[model samples]
Target chain A: MSVDAATVRRIAHLARIAVADHEIEHLRGEINNMLAFVEQLNEVNVDGVEPTASVEDMKLKMRDDVVSDGNYAKRVLANAPATDDGFFQVPKVVE
Target chain B: MNAPVRNPKLLKGDKHDWQVVIGMEIHAQVTSNAKLFSGASTEFGGEPNSHVSLVDAAMPGMLPVINKKCVEQAVKTGLGLKAKINKKSVFDRKNYFYPDLPQGYQISQFKHPVVGEGIVTVDMQDGSSFEVGIERLHLEQDAGKSLHDQHPSMSYVDLNRSGVALMEIVSKPDLRSAEEAKAYVTKLRTILRYLGTCDGDMEKGNLRADVNVSVRKPGDPLGTRCEIKNVNSIRFIGQAIEVEARRQIDILEDGGKIDQETRLFDAAKGETRSMRSKEEAHDYRYFPDPDLLPLEFDDAFIAKLKADLPELPDEKKARFVKDFGLSPYDAGVLIAERETAAFFEEVASGRDPKAAANFMINEFFGRLNKEDKTIEQSPISAEQARHDRRSDRRWHDLRQDRQRPLRNRLGRGWRPARGGREAWHEAGDRHRRHRKGRRRYHREEPGQG
Candidate 1:
């Protein structure tokens, strides 16, 4: 699949990334080249093969339902830009 | 009784009668000790951020491990609904942006859900029943809570609920009225409670629903549906569907088409307003997650879970009708809650089942409601009720003979049993004397003067 300028703009907007009007064409071309390189796999005739999420044929690992980790509120909120009373604070968002 | 020729809930429009179609998406928090993919506590009402693990906080290089209990719970719920449990299921990342979502994308099932289509038989208040088709059941992680009224310029974020496992059960558009929708939720909650998968506590937001409603002519094609999101109570769900359907009918009657969008139910104002238009809605690009492998299980695993299943509401109701010789309505009311059904069974054992049902439903339940207490909080236990039943029978026989008055039958200075009618009458007299706003039943001891 090839990417166009309009598609690039829409993608940028959906990702909440800002892009300049002139940079859309360059980004579009770069995306198209990457897609073309990945599209070479389409030439293979691999019908009836089950699509898999991981290359490794391994089962999903599971853990017992126990509370083994938590209660380090200080460390949890250490990287937050803002906090108040053990809670992360952000600009009001109501919808 | 004969089936009605038409549904009584059809709305009369200016030129024609309109029928409302509804579907529900219920999100029930899985009852587990830890979160779905992290080892963090899932207890409600903890200190903010105290339940957050590194994985839940989305720290760099933090990996997610599936919780075995959560998957088992989802399977148990699927079995309870008589749904198809897929041997293999995949979890996908639903891409979106929200302040409460620290991961920016929620891990959910999109194309391949864990449970497949099933049917829930919903019994209406009028003794009629309808089957609501289950589309699918998928597992997903819950987002953090955002409290908007916490501060003047900032909102407080609580991640205690983040990463909690939720089973999103979607139903087909088969509900024709608001009452059916309410009954459907009620029945689903009972089933989940029976399976012990979810607590079904709406007060703590453990269960919530998103209702999709549309209005169409009696025999026309389906109309555009507007989704009312995050309705917490069954009563509000009914009101929201009615209000949204009326709004659509009015618009269509005026030659204006309904705009499909997500709306919010303003319970205080009793109306639904648009939250976001269809054009501005988020396009959730879902894809399989690379961090986790596909969930695969064998038939033996499903068989083990199914064998451990408890008797569900429908089965219990049927048993009550056939074995206990109870009317369908009485059986339905008794088995609505697991505890109530157990209480009834305990009292009915080795006794007249019909009489026991009548006393429990008419007398015990009535008094419980008057005092605003549940079966667990009853002043009298089932054993006490059984003991009292004997004395009550004797009193009935004495009154039936008509040869002597009750006072004379119980000769002078001959005290009745502990919970006999005489003691109850004395307690009632005391209650009237001390009617100073006490809520409990005041009973005197057997030997007390």
Candidate 2:
């Protein structure tokens, strides 16, 4: 599938990234390149092979259900650019 | 079993006969100590951002690791519902933009869920039961809370709930009425509670549902469904379905079309309002996450989990009916919760099952309701019931011994009351005597008590 300027703009909007009109063509070409690379893999004949999501071929490691971490409100909120009363404040979102 | 005939209550409308079809998507928080992919605590009501971790906050270079217990809990719940457990399941990134969601995309299961089709049997209040088909149970990460009340121009984000594990159990559009929808959710919550997978506390937002409602003429093809999102209570689920169905019926009857969209139920107003139009909806570009491996387990693992499962509600109810000869309704009430079922077993064991049922339902439960307490909060103990049972056995023996002499003095039909005060006093005295004899016997026999 080829990516057009409109599709690139839509994707950028969906991703919440501000892309200028002049940069849409560049973004479209970059996305098309990635899509073309992904599409090439579809051309290979592998009817009998199982689809692989990870290369490790191993089970996902699981941790015990124990609460040994957390309770660091100060440290957790430290990375936020904006904060209020131990919370990460953001621009108002109304629904 | 075929789908239950559409509930007449849902079918009968003001102007014409209309049928309401409901499908539920219940989101139950998995009972886990930590978040789905992060080590942050999953405890509720934490101070804002207190329970968050680097992964929960969506910090750069953070990766998600699967919580094995949460997966096991999902599989256990699936088995309890008699659902097929997929040996392999994939996780996908559901791309969306929300301030509460720290990550631009939510890690969810789409196309390939951990659980496959299942069936939940819900018992109605009228001593009837119907099976609701489960579409699938997918694992997803919960977003954080956006506190809109704290500021005039900004919303405070609490990442404490972010990355928490949620089992999005989707049910087929098999429910016919608001009652059935409520019953279906009630049964599903009970099963989840029985499996210890979720607490099923809708008040705490641990369990919530997205109810899909539509109206149609009887025997007509299914109508367009408008989803009421995040209805948090069972009563509200029923009310929302009814209100939305009425709204649709009114629209159709007035020569208007019901738009397919997501709406929110106003509990205060007892109506549903449009939340988002279809034209402005998110695409949610779902794709397999490259960071995490597909979850796969063998038959041995499934078997082990199945073996470890406590006797589920349906099985316990069936045994109550078959072994204890309890009615299906009584059995259902008894087995609605694991604690209640265990308490029933303790009280009903080696006693008159029907009498035990009456005591539990009428006296025990009645007192509990009057006092506004749950079984977990009940002042009465199961050990007291055991003591009562022992006394009951002794009373039965004493009655048998006195039967001949009493028959000789009075008429043969004359007998003691089932739970008369006299019998209770006799049982108490007998218990005291028996205890004294046991103490004497222990004194006589060294080292035995």
Candidate 3:
């Protein structure tokens, strides 16, 4: 699969990245190259192979239902750009 | 009452009859002590951000670990719905941007869900039932709350609810009317509560529904459907469907086509307004999450969960009718809540089943409702009723005396009949004294006192 200019713009928008109009073609070419490099796997013939999410053949790890963490609101919001009353504050978002 | 019929005449348009179709997607918060992927407390009404963890806050280098109880809850809910539990399901990242979602994307299921198709049989108020097909059930994370009114030019975000587990149960477009939609949600909530997966509390925002509504002429093809989002109450769900259907019909009759988009229901105005147009539809751009592996379980795991399942509402209702000889209406009232059913069973054991049902339904529940108390908050206990059978008589007397308020009667303390017990005790003493006298005359055993 190859990425076109429009696809690049859409991706940038979805990722919340501010991409300039002049750089769309360059990003498209860069993305297409990446996709082509990863497309080498298409050469292999493994029709019956199962699709797996992880490289390791292991199931997801699950932890017991216990409340072992929390109550450190100060540290959680310490690095926020803005905070008020222990809440992360942002510009008013209506809707 | 007559059985409910799916009458197409119910939705009559200006020129022709129309049929309103509805489907629901219910988001139920998983009842867990901790967050789904973090060890943060999932307690409701906590101080803002007190339950936030590094993972929930999306801090750099922080990872999420799956909570076993949330997954188990999803599987239990699936079994309750009689749905197929997928042995392997993948978590996908649905990319979106909102202030409440610090991750800039939601970890959800798209291509592969935890549960597949199932059917839910909803009994209508008119003594009829219909089956609504379950499209799928998926597990996802809930977003934080964005309080817009906190400030004049800014919003505050509470991450207490972030990373909490939610089950998104989707249904097929099988509902025929607003009543059917309401009944469907009611039944779904009851089932979820019975499974102990979700509390199904709409007022607390534990359960919310997105209703899809479309209208088409009879025997015509399906029309473009619009979704009414985040309807929090069952009454509002019914009203939303009716309002959206009327809106669609009016547009179609005026030679204007329906625009498929998302709309928000205004409960105060009793109408629905478009939230977003189809041209600006969301492009979620879903992809598998690299942080977590595929969730896979074996047949043995499913069997264990299935075996440990409690008798659901439907089964308990059936048993109440068949074994206790209760009318369908009476049985329904009894099994509406799990606690109420348990209380009824305790009161009915080793007693006349029908009479116990009548007493509990007519007298017990009636009095509880009058006092605005739930079954758990009942003043009378099942053990008290079992030992003191006169409570039934007291209830009858209370019912006869309509002037006496329930609070007054209860405050007076519906005590057991001490007079009868004292009388029996006195009679027993007199008989024993007589026997002792006879014994003294026959065998001279007066010293045996």
lDDT of 1 at B343: 87
**Any runs in candidate 3 off by more than 4 Å, and if so which?**
A1-4, A35-44, B1-9, B277-281, B386-449
Candidate 2 — which pairs collide? Answer: none
How high is the DockQ of candidate 2?
Answer: 0.64
Question: Which clashing pairs does model 1 show?
Answer: none
lDDT of 3 by residue, B69-164 (tens): 999999999999999999999999988888889898889999999999988988766666778899999999999999999899999999999999
lDDT for B370 in candidate 3 is 44
- TM-scores for every candidate against the unseen true structure: 0.89, 0.86, 0.87
For model 3, the docking class works out as medium
Give the top-scoring candidate (TM-score): 1
Candidate 2 CAPRI category: medium
Q: Tell me the deviation in Å of residue B165 in model 3.
A: 0.4
Winner of 1 and 2 under lDDT: 1
Off by over 4 Å in 2: A33-41, B1-10, B277-281, B385-449
Please write out the lDDT profile of model 2 over residues A1-95, one tens digit for every residue: 99778888888888889999999888888899999998998899999998876567577777777776678888877868899888988999877
The CAPRI quality class of candidate 1 comes to medium
Candidate 2 fnat reads 0.85
What is the DockQ score of candidate 3, to 2 decimals?
A: 0.72
Ranking by lDDT: 1, 3, 2
